[model samples]
Target: MATFDSFFSKRTLIGLALGQFVSLVITSTAFSSSELSRRGISVPTSQSFLNYVLLAIVYGGFLVYKRKRSLQIKWYFYLMLAVADVEANFLVVKAYQYTSLTSVMLLDCWSIPSVILLTWLFLNTKYRFRKFVGVAVCVAGLVLVVFSDVHSRDRGKGLPHFKYGSGGSDPVKGDVLVLSGAMLYAVSNVSEEFIVKKGGRVELMAMLGLFGAVVGSCQMYPEILANI
Candidate 1:
């Protein structure tokens, strides 16, 4: 029998938390977008902006209560992080305006390879041959999916509920947006990995929430004013 501390170690807890966080984020994003679509409300950018605000509020409050300390990163580095993070969310959410969820799901895995390459180049991390093979496999799978989508699209059965008018609903444009968003997300994740690993930063989640809140709110200001 294992001891309680051994079973519930910090690493184990962190892993569990990370799994839960990823699942929650994915589920929430899918649910929110699907529900909004059902209601004919196309405001993914606005929703994405608000998500950051809520995260900032919740994490910032927690940080203040737990540590009561301010974060101190260089302005330029922080600016890069904020821009990458904000653009990642904004672009992905906005992609939904022009593309189907299926295409988004297939393309968003772009971050896996991007992060692997980034870590290898910037962080001097080395991986086994098997890992490289795994990446190649993933790429091959993605290529197949793309080809299939293209075939179906040519057959006039690509994506359902697709609408094109003055409103945004171009599948090609949406695919491009999703790919761009995925690449941006890769940049943000790579930057975060560098900051946390190389820069020896702690309380990363809190910092992200706070910065996201600030950046997201700033972007959303015009929309807020227009709505008001």
Candidate 2:
């Protein structure tokens, strides 16, 4: 008796949890791998571009299979989402250059509160007292993590010796970047929620992937040319 909407309702929490786990793994692995690599590692924009490319391919295939008609939403809307997503990914990835993996991960939780506030303001979504309490707890946790950054000295042998991005190995700068990225991610997520609710498109994810790939690739082109 579970309908399509029911599947999303049932799995939303689970999906969120799994997504967090996967993101942590990806970030941590990227940090560790880049430090150990002999050659220069991929930059944040390149990594984001490549990820979206694969995503777009998969999603494009899905659209082909489903035989969906024209894209329901405006191209600019997807451009907005793609820009937010690409910016978030670039910022978060760049943050690793300036701070510990632990610090970046902890600070990235800012998206939860950011999303809540943005949804309230733009989406007109309401929350209960408990939700606010949860945000308070998240704030407390962020404070603890930020304070902990001052005591962190474990860079380990695998980490790179030189600075990677403009962040320049400053924990505060890194934390700020992570927090900013989280806010952008919140924006993208809230927009996606609104689009899904209003447009009622089951293939929203695929469309996002397609648009993200295009925008991300375009953004990466300049960096690639400069580096080359």
Candidate 3:
């Protein structure tokens, strides 16, 4: 009875609700990216560019209203963070061009282990035995997913079949892109968490929004030109 009550506690329920909301948003983004790829449109950077712009406008407005004399964190640090964030978004969205949505979502779990290691090494975070067990389970699941993909490819004899998006797309390449993006996501998440804890959420968001928009814009320019 106590365990059940704790599991369904108000805070726990709220957390679960928030988690589901985030999951829905992420799934929707993946679906949109896949749909665009199906229609032969692959502007991954452009898709994320507007989001950064919105963040800049909203949070940056708050900072301007507060009228702080100087930023708590250095501008260059945010620049690096934004670069990682932009590349992470780019790679994950781009993965939809060559992989199944299911595979992209599953392989994106690679960020869990990456985040664990990053926090431990950079932030000196300590984990309990249960946390390690959880991470181990996640890794095992990822291994099984990879094995299944490889087995499927073997059975198909390396022929390009319509598994997900467009025909002739390579799932392996997409998986690699997702994993790479996941690593960058881990880096960005850890750094952002640390900075936010030390500084202020408003400042962090404003700077990230500012730098992310610039970085995303720089990358999207070439993409736009290529598409044109």
Ranking by lDDT: 3, 2, 1
Task: Give model 3's clash tally.
Answer: 0
- The residue-by-residue lDDT of candidate 3 on 30-116, one tens digit each, is 889989887888799999998889889999999999965788788899999999999999999998887778888988999999999
Preferred candidate (lDDT higher): 1 or 3:
3
Give TM-scores for every candidate, taking all chains together and pairing residue i with residue i: 0.75, 0.74, 0.91
The CA lDDT at 50 in model 2 is: 64
Between which residue pairs do clashes occur in model 2? none
Candidate 1 segments whose C-alpha is farther than 4 A from its true place: 1-21, 61-72, 157-168, 198-203, 222-228
- Relative to the true structure, how large is the alpha-carbon lDDT of every model? 0.70, 0.75, 0.86
Residue pairs in steric clash, candidate 3? none
Please list the residue runs of candidate 2 whose C-alpha ends up more than 4 Å from where it truly belongs after superposition.
1-42, 148-168, 200-202, 225-228
Clashing pairs in 1: none
**Candidates, ranked, TM-score:** 3, 1, 2
Q: Write the per-residue lDDT of candidate 1 for residues 32-100, one digit (tens) a residue.
A: 775665466655556766666666677667667877545555646766687788877777776666656
